[model samples]
Target: MSSLEIVKQYYTSFNQKNWNGMLALLHPEVRHEANQGDVRIGTGKFTEFLQKMDESYEETLTDMVFFTEPADSRVAVEFVVNGIYKKGEEGLPEAYGQTYVLPAAAFLELKEGKISRVTTYYNLPLWIELVSKPRND
Candidate 1:
């Protein structure tokens, strides 16, 4: 599959909340550069991250626009995350099913048609601010 196709599938899996499908596109030694934490290597670590995220939040990517490098080995995607904070995470605001919308982007590197590295970026403070506000409902 083409690099763009692979990335499209990656996000499709993510939107579907299909953890195994997302993992299927990754290289065995895939490197994940998280937005606000240490780099995590391998699919195992990625699985743990996904599990934690699944426990704390429910998210879907929207307004997606994808860009690919001339070499076809690198892909970048810009999207908005529409999410609900379902459970509290350490060092973060308490969750009362708070909903938030945040813009985010991710850069991916592909090797042999598999995602070898993924680096994601998002505004943490903005998210915190959005979720911290008291909801009328």
Candidate 2:
């Protein structure tokens, strides 16, 4: 498969919350960086991250727009993920069914048709608010 196809499927798998499919597109030594400075490496760590994301949200990914330039070997994706709280999360100020439309982007690097490195850029502060976890004490 081409890099673009691989990346596209990656998003599709994630939106579907298909852990197995998502894992298949990831390199064994894949590395991921989110908005935070923290860097996650290894398949185990990546798997954990996916698990947490799935466990937190109630709905699946909705509208998404993908932009790519074949020459650059990079793709930028913007999407709105709608979901509710899973209940019993300490920072959760409200119950389930709260709707959130988060606009997020990700920069990806492909190697051998697999995702090797991913740098995620998004408004994390906005997410905190959407998830009802205000940073202010």
Runs in model 1 lying further than 4 Å from the true structure: 135-137
lDDT of 2 by residue, 1-137 (tens): 76778888998887777889989888899889977757999778999877776676665665777777866467777776666666434544655545667777788887777788888876867866786654353
* Positional deviation of residue 115's Cα in model 1 after best superposition, in angstroms: 0.4
| Runs with alpha carbons beyond 4 Å of true place in candidate 2 | 87-97, 133-137
Backbone collision tally, model 2: 0
Q: Deviation in angstroms for 8 in model 1?
A: 0.2
Model 2: ten consecutive residues of lowest lDDT: 87-96
Per-model TM-score versus the true fold: 0.97, 0.80
Per-prediction CA RMSD (Å): 1.0, 4.0
RMSD of 1: 1.0
Q: Write the per-residue lDDT of candidate 1 for residues 9-128, one digit (tens) a residue.
A: 999999999999999999999999999989999999999999999999999999999999899999999999999999998899999999999999999999998999999999999999
Residue 13 of model 2 has an lDDT of: 82
**For this target, which candidate reaches the highest TM-score against the unseen true structure?**
1
Winner by lDDT: 1
